[model samples]
Structure formats: structure tokens, C-alpha cells
Target: MGVRVLGPRDLSAARAVIARDPVVNVFVDSLVQTSGLDPRRGAEVWGYVEKGVLEALCHAGGNMVPVGAGEAALRAFAAYALRRGRNCFQILGPARAVEVLWEALEPHWGPAREVRDDQPFMVIDGPPVITPDPLVRAVEPVELPILYPACVAMYTEEVGVPPQTGPDGTFYRSRVAELIRTGRAFARIEDGKVVFKAEIGSVGTGVCQIQGVWVDPERRGEGLAAPGMAAVVELARQLTPVVTLYVNAFNTPARAAYERVGFRTVETFATILF
Candidate 1:
């Protein structure tokens, strides 16, 4: 039993592993599909192979996501990350997988800066139960200036860090722009201000993971999140077979809004932010 680095030559094998759970695996699937398993792009995949058969895989670098896991494989992947001085932004996946991997990682890596231990991994298999908000629509290129502030506010509020941690906010701005370019960004604009917003954070492996959902602070009690989310899910389904997202269990209002929009808790996810 050994874990080895995977590269472009292992693309088919990687695809097969990711396909096992398209929703939970889309972030890694997108990386491998677009970056081709290359370390050059600051991301690489490692496979837990035994007897020449790949049993599990771990994605390292930007996000330390593990898929197709087993105890042995998860432990090995964690050890590898420890050895490489892993500084990935988060470790997210099925609760069991992330838990086992973290068990191996935490002893050596020390305390996590932040953790959402009870994130509800939700999915929508069909059209939503709520009516889609007609105001919510795909954000256009011209609206980036109007939408960028809302995106920044949402990211900062949800993640507990200023997205402009870079020299001039260029890194965060470019990332939001890239999502908009892909037509994955959506928002409800009213009077030239974004009132509600969401984005497809990952797109691959027949799924899209929605993230960065937000409603303006003043509009919080206006009953916008449910219908707004319904619209977002409808738009997201046009690009993938399904939509998935993980929300902190403590966020009761968000949870209720999502349930009203037809998303069910399919699994549990844990996220450790470094």
C-alpha cells in the first residue's frame, strides 16, 4: 500500500475516482480537468494505490479535498500533507473522510484557525419547491463594478477574512471576475445595487458547487433568500446535472432558506480553514 503523486498520465484514473461522487468531488474534478493533474499549476493529485489499483485520491494545494476514501488512504493523504507543509485554504469533503484525514493531520499540524464542524452538505435533485425570484439573474460583465462590493462583503462575512489579503485586492477581484466570465455568477440588482447574490464555486464532474451566497444586510428580513436561492439553483442546473453546497449548521436561517428551495441534507461536511 502506497500513495503516489498523479500527473497528466493518470487523468483517466482521476476522472473515474471523481465520478464516484460528482457533487462532493467537483472542485477537484475541475482542477484535474482544467489543470491536468499538474503540479505546475500549484495543484496536484495523489492516489492511494494498493496492488496497482487506485483506491482513493487526495487533492492538495488550493483545497485539500479527499475522495473515494478509506481509513488507510485518508491517513496516508494526511501524512503526505503534513510532510509537504500543507497550507491549503480548507479541507472539505464527506464528513467521515475529512474527519479521518484531519485526525491524522491535526496532531502534527496543531490547531486549526477556524472550523465549521457541522456543515450541512446539501443537494437539489430537481426543480425547487419555491418560486424563483424574477429579479435574480445572471450577472453581466457590465455589472461587475456594481456586484464586486457585494461579492467582497459576502466573502469577508462568510469566510472571516478580507478577500483583499493581497497587495491591492487584485487577487480577489480577478477571481470574482473569472467566475462572472464563466457566467456562473448571479445576483439580484435593484436600483443599481446588488441585493442578493450567489456563485458556482466549482464546475465539473456533472455538478456545480454553489458558494458565496449572500443577501444585503438591510434586506435580511425581507424573505429574499429562499426565492433568490431558487433562482440561483435554477440557473446552476442549466450548467450541471445537479447543484450542491455546504452551509454551517449554526446558520439556521440559511438552512431554512435552502430547505424551502428544495435542497436536502444529503451528507455532512466539515471544513478546517487554515
Candidate 2:
């Protein structure tokens, strides 16, 4: 078996590999649908071929994500990634695959900043079970000023660091604005403050990945998250048939909220953040 950079010519075959698990591969599949292995899109996919079949791929860029990778494929991808140097901030994918790949890369790229090994990959493919929160609605573009701080707070609280270190938060702000513009950002705002918020971060292959789910610390026990997520599921299904998200296993409340909204664990993922 050999691993090599995939190109536009390999689009169909590469997509076949991603299609093996649409839910787990939605992030990379979205990139393939939009960019088709074009490096200009900020990433390139590396394919692993065995017995003349394209069996696995790694999305190489800011986030290195492996799809359909087995034990052998993981080893080959690790060698390729090692040769390419550590340019990614994280290595994330199916739990066992990421575990094996990191086993190969850690010696060379030791001392990772963090390793999140127990993330439940959950999905909801049908209408939400709970009544959707009528008050939870898509954020309007003009409301970015209100939503922006909540986003930063969510990022800092979840990731253990603020999204931006400097006073200027242009990049993170622009991303939030884009989500709002696309009607993918949802929030429950009261008194000009975001009480709960989430965004559809990645969409492809009839699946959409939800990210940045947040409930205001002050409003934690007020029963906001589940209905807010139910509202998000109703809105998200307008764009894709399936809604998926992953949560740190330690985040019991968030996990319970998602489950209450009709999501179920389908897989496990691991993240090695550097």
C-alpha cells in the first residue's frame, strides 16, 4: 500500500472513500464537495491505496482528519504526515485511528498540548423529539455585536483559550458573520444578550455538523440548551437530512442535553491538539 496526495483527477475515488461513513467524514466530505482536493481551499487530501483501491484519506491542513483509515492506512498516513512536518494544530478522527496515528507521530511530535481521547460522535437524522424552542431563532447579521462576545466566551470556555489573543478578533468575527449570513447561526437572545447559541459548521453528503453549542453560564439551570438545540435541529434539517456533533465525554450536561434532543452516539473521536 502507498499514500500520496490526491488531486482533482482522483475526486470520484476520493469521494468514494469519504462516503464509506458520511456522518464521521462529513467535515472532509464538505471540503471535497466544495473544493475537490484543491490546495487553495486551505487543505489537500492524502489518499492511501491498497490492492489498486483507494481505501483511506487524510485531510491535511490546519486540522488533519483521517477518514476510513484502518490500522495499515493509519501507519502510512503517519509517515506522510511526519515527512510533511507538523503544520496542523490538531489530529482528529475516529478514536482508534487517531490513537494509532498519534502513536506513530508522537515520538517525533511529542509533548502535544492536549489529548482529548473520549469524544462521543453523535447524530440526529430525524425530526427532534422535544418541542422546538420558539424563542430560539437564527441570529441576524446586525446582531453580530451581541453574538460575538458569546462566541468568544464559548470558545474560551470550551477550548481553554480565547479564540483571539489580541484586541482585534477579525478572523473569528468574520467566521461568525459568515455563519449568521448563511442562516446557520442560532441563538436565544434576551435583554440583548445571547442566552444560548450554536452553529452549523460543516455541511456535505446530506449531513451537517453542529459546533460551538453554548449556554450562558448564568442561565445554565434554566432549561435552555435542550429546546435551543431542538430548534437548531429543526432549522438544520432544512439544509441537510442529518445533524451531527461531537462532545467531550466529560461534558455530561451537554451530552445529556443533546441526547434529550434526540441525538444518539454513533461513533467515538479523539483529538490531539498541539
Candidate 3:
């Protein structure tokens, strides 16, 4: 098997490998197009091939590097990362794959820090039922000013870490705003108050990613999450055939909420923060 940096010439083969991997949710087609448009800010995606048939792949974006594959493929990908000056790497795959890769690399990289425990990723194949209760309404563009604060509050209360303000906030806000402005975000408001929200990202031919899901603590247990998430799923279905989202493994409440909306656990991914 040979590992190589993927370019425009290798895009077709690289996409095939990603499509074969059930756990890959980044929508390789959209990534390739976006990367091609702006080569400098694009993430580096590597493909592993044997006899010219792609078998595995990995993605490195900024400080986050997600490596997914078997032992041999992972080792080869790791070497490629090392050669490219990547010090920190995050492996997002099954628990067994993560265990194997971490064990193999520990000796050379000191100790691998378990930044976060395994996270459960939920995938929705069909339309989600809009549950009755808590009154959900689609948010308007004018409500973003209010929605942003509520989202930050919800994230802080549930995740224990407040959303970063200033440039960090700007980064996230701008990204979400861009998605919303482009009709990719949906909000669930209760009595004119933004209680929950979800957004779609990285759309491809057959897949779309659902991200930035949040619910206000005050509105918890009222059964608003299912319909709130369903709104995003409904929106995604309009653009793609499938929808997927990732959640922190330890967050049981979020998992339960998503399950109620017809999302099933498809895989586990680790989020390595440096």
C-alpha cells in the first residue's frame, strides 16, 4: 500500500474511499470543491492506496487531525503527518481503532492525552417527527442577535464552558451566520424566545452534516429537542439524502434527545483539542 497527498488529479479516487467509509460524515465532495477553490486555507486530505485502489484516508484541518483506518493504514498516515510537521493528531473512528492507533504511537509521542472521551455520532436517514410541546418556531434573520446570546447561554450551561467571546465568538458566529444567511440554519423558538437551534454544513450529493445544536437549560425536559433537531433534518433533506451529527460521548442527555428524534448511533469519534 502507498500513502500520498491527494491533489486535483486524485480527487475522484479519494472521494470513492470516503464514500465507502460509513463513518466519514464530512461530505468529501463539498470539501474537495471548497478546497480546490481556496487551496491555501483548505485542509490536507491523504489517501492510502494499494495497487492503485484506495483503502483509507485521513483529514487534517488546522490543529485538528482526524485519522481513520486500520493499523497499517493509520501507521502510514501517521508517518505522513510527521513528515508534514503535524505534532498533534486526533483519531476519529471506532473505539478499537482508536485504542490500536494510540497504543502504537504512544512510545514515540510521549503520552497521548485523552482530551475528551469517545463521542457518539448520530445519523438520521429519514425525516424526523416534529414532536408536540414547548412550541417550536423557525427563527428569522432578525432574531440572530437574540439567538446568538441564547445559544451561548445554552452551550455554557450544558457544556460547562461558555462559548468564547471576541474573535473566537466572531469565528463561530460568522460561520453560523453564513450558514443561516444561506438558509442552512433553523431555530426553535418558544413564545418568541430562542430556546433551541440547529444548522447544516458541508453538503454533498448524498449527505449533509447537522451541527451546532443547542437547547436552553430553562426549556429542558419539555420535549423541544426532537422537533428542534427535526427542523434541521427537514431542512437538510431538502438539500441532501442523509443527515449526520456528532455529540460528545459523555453527554448522555444530548444522546437521549437525539435518539428521540430518530437519530441512531452510527459511530464514535474523538475530539482532540490542543
Candidate 4:
């Protein structure tokens, strides 16, 4: 088997490999489109080909962000990425592969901080039991003031970064609005106030990724996440056979809520932010 940088000629095979793994595939497609990063540039999607058959795939781009793949293929891909002088790397994949890659690369990049711990990439199958919540519903166009604050609060509190403001805020809002425009955003409103929100990202090959799940602090103990999440899952299921989302390993409450909504842990991934 041999490994090499993906070129335009490799798109067909690359697409096929991506299609086989929908969660990572959707994320890759979204990154290519939303981040304005050209997959044809420093970006490379490497495949392990044996006897004219592609058996494994790995992707590296933009500071060497690495997504999951087979161990042998990833090791080969990392060799190529390091040759380009990319020291910083992020690995989102199975726990074993991550541990192996991190150990192998320690000689080059030193110790890697666990920016995101070994959290599960969960998938929701079957109809979700969305409990009735007076505060949960679809967000409307006229409720930006109510909705924006709730979103900002959740983003800052849960994500540990202040909500983007000014130009950055504009970009963030536009990105969210694009998702809403594409029928991806869902919310729960009570007394005309938005309290919780969730959205699914791009859908391809029967897999949709859930993103930006949030709830008002005051509404946390009220059991609002499951239903709000359920609504999003139900909506995404229209386009795909399964819905997937990632949660921080340390956030037990969020993990419990997701499990209540029929999501099961499938794989553990590490997000290394430098």
C-alpha cells in the first residue's frame, strides 16, 4: 500500500471514502466550504491503496488538523504533513488511533494538551422522545434580540469564549443565519423568549451532524435539553438516516442529556487547540 497527497484526480476515490464515513465526511465538507480552505492547497486527503483498492483514508490541512482513519494510513499521512513543517496538529478520531499518533508525534510536537478530552461522537437513531416543554419551539425571524442573547450566553459559557462581537459577531450571525436559511436551526421559546437552541450541519449520505446545542442557565434544571435536542434530531432525520454530535468528556450533564435522547457513544475523539 502507498500514500500520497490527494489531487483533483483523486476526488472521485476520496469522495467515495468520505461517503463511507458520513460524520467525518460532513465535517470535512463543511470545513472546506465554511473555512474557505482549499482542499487542493496545503490540504491533502491521503488514502491507503493496496492492489489498486483504496482501503483507508486520512485528511490533513490548515496547521495539520487530522481527522480519524486507519493507524497505518494515518502514520504515513503524518509523515507527509510533518515534512511540510506543520507542527501543530488536531486529531479527531478513535481513542486508540489518537493515542498512537500522539505518542508517535511526541518526538516532533512534544506533549499535546487535551483541549477536548476523550468524548464520544454519538449518533441518534430512531424517533427521539421529545418531551413537552413550554419553553421549546422553533425560532422565529422576529426574535433575534431574545434568541441572540441566549445563544451568546450559551456559546460563551459552554465554549469558554466570549461571543463574537462587531465584525466577528456579524460573521458568526451570518454563519448561523445561513444555517437557519437552510432549515438547520431549531429552538424552544417560552413567553416569546428563546431559551434553548440546536442546529444540524450539512447532511450527506444518510448522516447529519448536530452542532451548537445550548440552553439558558436559568432553564438548565428544568430538563429542556432532551426535547430541544430531540426536535433537532427529528428534523435532521428527514435528510439522513442518523444524526451525530460531539460533547466534551468533562461535561457529564450534557452527556447524560444526549443519552436520554437516544444517542449512543460510538467513538472518542481528541481536539487539540493550539
In model 4, the worst 10-residue window by lDDT is 31-40
Which ranges in model 3 have alpha carbons more than 4 Å from their true place? 27-29, 63-68, 87-91, 104-114, 130-139, 151-169, 190-193
Off by over 4 Å in 4: 1-3, 23-26, 29-53, 61-68, 87-89, 110-113, 130-135, 140-149, 162-169, 191-193
Q: Which structure among the candidates has the greatest lDDT?
A: 2
lDDT of each: 0.88, 0.92, 0.66, 0.67
Error of 1 at 58 (Å): 0.8
The sequence of per-residue lDDT tens digits that candidate 3 reaches over residues 7-31 is 7777766666666653354654567
Who is ahead in lDDT, 1 or 3?
1
Evaluation by lDDT, superior candidate among 2 and 3: 2
Between candidates 2 and 4, which one is better according to lDDT? 2
Per-residue accuracy of model 1 over 1-274 as CA lDDT, tens digit each: 7888998888888889888877778778878888888788757789999888888889887688898888988988887787788768888888888888888888877588887789999999799888999999998988889989998899889989877457775888888888899899999999999999999998896788999999999999899999999999999999887899999999999999999999999888889887
Clashes of 3: 1
lDDT of 2 by residue, 5-71 (tens): 9889899999888888898999999888888787776588899999988999999987999999889
**lDDT by residue (tens digit), candidate 4, 24-106:** 55676555434233454545666667678676665565334344367776677667656765534356555666666666676
Per-residue error at 17 for model 1, in Å?
Answer: 1.1
Candidate 1 worst ten-residue window by lDDT: 161-170
Ranking by lDDT: 2, 1, 4, 3
